[model samples]
Target: MSDAPGPDQAGPQTQLPDPPRPPLPPTAPERGGPRARLLGIAGLVLTVLFLPAGLVLSIAALVTGVRSRKRARRVLAPAPGAVAGIVLAVISLVLALSQITLYAIAWDDLNGYVTCRESALTIDDKKTCQDEYLPRIEHRFHLPKGSLRQDPSWP
Candidate 1:
């Protein structure tokens, strides 16, 4: 028989399989749940309104957001709300820290001013101390002159 098959002699042709498809890219985590979203909103609002409360709320939100993100990541879903909450929490934390630092500096300056006045050797020296430090403290804190006061009750 001839090597080449005629129409009648030809058997059913075997089809080649298609090439394998590439794997899909990883998807973002799922959106955070209701509690997480609420916490994010609350945290952001408190951060703007009351710094101390905001700091606390921000910490709570960060914790909640991180947990929500972890849960979503396990399921391979998007967690946009959780991510936003985390970001807002970080900003709130930074603002709270800055305020705390400023307060500490102002307190230290006031204390130093009191010490300077008490340690002055004469009326002139006391006047010089006030003249030198009062302006600096006022300028730094944007306070009116002579706003700093020393109370005997305070240690």
Candidate 2:
């Protein structure tokens, strides 16, 4: 036989290169800090819980939420509660403004009731004043008779 293998003889097989793998998906960047998260949480809390100072608190919440979102963007982080805080703050502001408007509209009527209640010395007299005032308030607001009740809760 010759030194080279014949066509029937098997020689060493050539190795093929590996098929290219698909690239791995890129990962999300790490968040920078907790300042934005804290601000957003605080703003959301203030907007929801402290409703007595409605207009002022709502404005404050709005400001903080805006700041939180801005800071988060600057830090390349996500703003978690900032959007909720802003939305609630706007809703609170609208309710607060509507309350103020209604109060202004009912000022004289409310004042008369207040003066009557304050001047009355006896429980019977206060009850009488309330009885007279309730109907008027109900009528003005187009509510059912006895629908609105006021309790001074004084001793």
Candidate 3:
């Protein structure tokens, strides 16, 4: 006496149309245009890992990051790695510049210190080397007297 359809009995089925999907945004930054993630990562690695090439690579990273940001803005898309890349590049640039300055300004002094330390045969000899190095270096920087003390582990 059941009115419902039974097994093997076909019932009337009406399919509803799929819900309308909102169209994608105007443009996707992550989609098709030149991806800057590789550059960003390369710049970051160069800055942190290889300082010899960091001076050049840092500048490259900075330029690429800035360009990426500009391009993203021009296209009105969100930038993913631009800001991070720029920040890291700036830090690396500073470190690279400082390294260059130290080498350029105190090359002879540093060379002398290394040679003296290498030839030192005893703790007293090393201490003497430290004494000579500290004064010269302090004078170069115009540091106040007693500003820098010799390391106890000069050996």
Candidate 4:
């Protein structure tokens, strides 16, 4: 027999090289932008709890949330928390403004009442002035009736 193997005893077969694998898709730098979401939530909580500090925190949240959203858009990600933060900030600001306005009206009404009472010559005149003016002030300020009379010394 020749040195080469016979047909029945074939030599070892050659193995083919593996095909190249496709490159993986690029990953986002931020993992779902959780930092932005957290900041937004923190801002909303602060705004609700403390008005004075809330203004600053709310503004910061807005800025951070906007920046996060822009970055997320570039990566085609969602930013729902940022939108919520902005809405909450606006609501807190409105509440603060309304509270300030109410306090001012209350102060004005009290001052007016005191002035009216001081100008009266006697207890009957004071009573008459209070009866006439208190109702008008309450109506104008949308205060509950007898709100000014809660303290007898107010008259």
Q: lDDT by residue for model 3 over 96-154, one digit each (tens)?
A: 77777877887887788889999999999987887888677778778775566644553
Error of 2 at 51 (Å): 6.2
Quote the RMSD, in angstroms, for model 1. Answer: 11.9
Which 10-residue window of candidate 4 scores lowest in summed lDDT? 25-34
Model 3 scores worst on lDDT over the 10 consecutive residues at: 28-37
- TM-score, one value per model: 0.50, 0.56, 0.63, 0.46
Model 4, 1-155: lDDT tens digits are 67887789978789999999998643342422444455556655665677667667666666666776676688776655666655665665676677667667677766777787888899998988789888877798787999977877764
In model 4, what are the clashing residue pairs, if there are any?
none
Q: What do the candidate models score in CA lDDT, each in turn?
A: 0.74, 0.66, 0.70, 0.67
**Model 3, total clashes:** 0
Q: Which residue pairs in model 1 clash with each other?
A: 28-77, 29-77, 29-78, 30-77, 30-78, 31-78
- Which residue pairs clash within candidate 3? none
Once model 4 is optimally superposed onto the true structure by TM-score, how far is the C-alpha of residue 135 displaced, in angstroms? 7.0
Q: Which stretches of candidate 4 lie over 4 Å from their true place?
A: 1-40, 107-140, 147-155
Q: How accurate is candidate 3 locally (lDDT)?
A: 0.70
Best by lDDT: 1
Model 1 alpha-carbon miss at residue 151, Å: 27
- Give the Cα-based TM-score of candidate 1 against the true structure: 0.50
